[model samples]
Target: MQREGRRDSWEEEIKENSSAVERVLKLVEEDAVVLFSKSGCCISVAAKALLSTLGAHPTVHQLDKEKEGEEMEGALLTMLAAPPAVPAVFIGGKLVGGMEQLMSCHITGSLLPLLKEAGALWF
Candidate 1:
């Protein structure tokens, strides 16, 4: 019975993980900009603030606070061609990467064009 219980629990976990992965996939394509972040992460805060300051109001998802955040994060890592790290930025249904990449785009003056292309910016 004990062994069976563990197996059952494992199966349940797998189901939940699958659901989380599906959710993550949907979320990334949900808006012109989607930020998969953690509330406690300063980098996440910075990324959001920067985007907001640039006049782009992105759809923010604090994965760490969600019931399936860990699973989603795990799925993100697997889904992306790069390593998983929060806050993950998705723009125009493309993985734009983390805070550094975002800032680089901003600094290089490419971010606005990308935003415009994605329909997240008009001005």
Candidate 2:
């Protein structure tokens, strides 16, 4: 009974993880610009600010406040292989990576084009 209980628990965890991953995938697919963030994270705040400044009305999902946040965070970490996955940005249904990648694209003048393509920016 004890061993069976452990196995059942493991199965449930796997199910939840799968659901979280699916949820994240659906969110990224449905939005032009999706930002997975945590409210109190400074880098996330900066990412939001930068996108807003660039004319992107990003679909911001605050993982820390969401009901499935922890599971979603775990799924994000596994999917992106980026530790501390909050503040992850996805544009045009593609991973735009974290702050560093965002900064790089902006510096290279590529961010605006991508945003325009994604319909996150009109200009």
Candidate 3:
């Protein structure tokens, strides 16, 4: 019984520490390019790939159904209300919609310019 209690306490501590670390990381990336995605989403994958190909290393926030709890869901909802979708990109704390919008910007030769304007890229 004592061993089981100890194990449970250890698990709780680990969870708390992990949450704290995540919060710290979120704050550390001041000019963050956040991609709210999930595994097995083709659009999200392509969006991430596009960012990488453009020489931008975005902080990918995988919102797995099993892992997303109230806090995360609430945050997402507050930021992007109505019909929440994957691959939602937030560049320097600004929401920049999904892959379709990205593709449009790319075709117009405007995406890179926008990144530069946002100071997210050094070119």
User: Among these predicted structures, which one has the highest lDDT?
Assistant: 2
TM-scores, each model vs. reference: 0.77, 0.82, 0.62
Runs of candidate 1 with Cα error greater than 4 angstroms are 1-19, 79-84
Q: What 10-residue stretch in candidate 1 is worst by lDDT?
A: 76-85
RMSD of each: 8.2, 7.1, 12.0
- Give lDDT tens digits, candidate 2, residues 1-93: 986886666566557699898888899999899999988899998998999998898899999898999889887776565477878999998
- Over 4 Å off, model 3: 1-29, 65-84
Supply the global lDDT for candidate 2. Answer: 0.86
Clashes of 2: 0
Better of 2 and 3 by lDDT: 2
Writing each residue's lDDT as its tens digit, candidate 1 over 1-123 gives 986886666566556678876797688778999999877888888899998888888999988788888888876665443464688888998888888889999999999998999999778
Q: Which lDDT values do the candidates have, in the order given?
A: 0.82, 0.86, 0.65
**How far is 78's C-alpha from truth in model 3 (Å)?**
6.1
Candidate 2 to truth, TM: 0.82
State residue 112's C-alpha deviation in candidate 1, in Å. 0.5
Residue 49, candidate 3: alpha-carbon lDDT = 87
